[model samples]
Target: MNNVEITRAGLPDISRIVEIENNLFPDPWNEQAFRDVLFYYSNTFFTLKSDGDIVGFITAGIEDTSEVLYGHIMNLAVVPEYRKMGLGGRLMQRMEYEFIVSGAEGSQLEVRVSNGDAISFYKKLGYSQVMVIGGYYNNGEDAVLMMKWF
Candidate 1:
């Protein structure tokens, strides 16, 4: 993690973040979506930089319901060259830490059901499957909802 920094993302970082999203996911969020998230939920959007280059990012937000307050991880991804270097896990840990500090009781996220690697990764991080949502993606794929209580 030498020379790597994790910081709150700004509008200036949207283009690079969008590039990563497009490269990693089939249904990527557009620039406007990133802009909205940064504008409305700035506290939960973060970017990872290595040697001054954008390499990864994670987006999450606090969800307040009548029953409970929790954190929802909306998106997370690292550039291919940065994968397996502990960057993803570090990004997740940072987000969860922020959530915990913000009084969230737990955190949740949805992963593509077909993404076994991601499922395993989340599981290793102590996230367990809570439910499955059918047709969760624009492409009609299912999503596995996972959660972890702090």
Candidate 2:
């Protein structure tokens, strides 16, 4: 395993990130969503680089309330070749750190209801199931909303 570098994604990294997305998820983010993450929310969108390759990545945004702020993890993926090497953990840790530094009181994400592996991962990371949304995906699959507080 090489040094895992977590950094914000630049315009040039968009294509590779999209490739990672397509390789990792059954339904991946579209090009415009990737562009939005970089162009509009670059500060919170991040990628994990190993030997100059995008091995893992995550995107998030801040939500403000009257008394505090929160962070929402929009998407996360780790290249199949890079899985089980702590790359996913590294990416999540980086995102949580950013949330804390940005005064976010909590973090949230929604996962495919049937994705047991991801559910377990989030559970180990201290995220607890909060709710479920019916027919959340384009194919009418359900989704589970999970959350954790820093």
Candidate 3:
């Protein structure tokens, strides 16, 4: 992890972020989605770079309700070669810290029910499955709604 850095995402990183998104998910987010996150929630959007090349990213937003302010992790991805190196965990910790700084009481995210690896990862981060969203994805895959209290 020497020389690896996590920095706020900028407009220029969109193309590479989308490229990584397209490669990882069956229904990946488009360029405009990444743009919207950078435009609207830049405070919680971040990119991980190694040797000056973007290798991973996370997009999150803070949502306030009557009872609680929650941090929503909308998207996260790391280049295939960068997996299993703790880069993803680093990105997650960064976002969680930002959430705490922003006065959020907890964080929430959705994961494909069949994605055992992702679910396990989130669980390792202290997130627990709260519910299942039926037909959550465009392909009708169910999503497990997970939450972690701050």
Candidate 4:
């Protein structure tokens, strides 16, 4: 709620996104990965800005298969200083809104099993745990798959 603005991210924002990713995650996505997403999945990529600085971002995509289409949240992150301020929820809501507008039936994401806070946050947004995947992360951490039906 710090006057945050959500906007589509572009190539110019990848460096800053990479910086935040490296600082926040143990197995961070590199510049090339960001570049790939921005280039191929630009429509679903968004950045949260505050006073002209990038404070957070969410990367999502539409998955269409078997006559069903749904949204997939690939990554979501906010700077440590900006956490717990409802920014994460706002970002998610914004993405969900987009998904709803795009004819998506629901949204899905995977959270690290050890990330209790994130699991709770997703639960607060009406996401339910569907299952657990073993060794989902490169670091050997399990992941809890969560889904929300629109």
The C-alpha TM-scores of every prediction are: 0.97, 0.95, 0.98, 0.97
Alpha carbon deviation, residue 16, candidate 1 (Å): 0.5
lDDT of 2 by residue, 1-150 (tens): 677798889888888988888877778898889998778778888889988887778898888887879899999998778888777887888888989999999999999999999999999999999999999988898999999988
Q: Which of the two candidates, 1 or 2, achieves a greater lDDT against the reference?
A: 1
Off by over 4 Å in 3: none
The C-alpha stretches of model 1 lying farther than 4 A from their native spots are none
Candidates' lDDT values, in order?
0.94, 0.88, 0.96, 0.94
What's the best-to-worst order under TM-score? 3, 1, 4, 2
Candidate 2 least-lDDT 10 residues: 79-88
lDDT of 3 by residue, 42-95 (tens): 999999999899999999999999799999999999888889999999999999
Best by lDDT: 3
Q: What tens digits encode model 1's per-residue C-alpha lDDT throughout 1-150? A: 569999999888999999999999999999999999998889999999998889999999999886888999999999988899888999999999999989999999999999999999999999999999999999999999999999
lDDT against true structure, model 1 = 0.94
Each prediction's total of clashing residue pairs, residues at least 3 apart in sequence or on different chains, is 0, 0, 0, 0
Q: Which parts of model 4 are misplaced by more than 4 Å?
A: none
Q: By the TM-score metric, which is better: model 2 or model 4?
A: 4
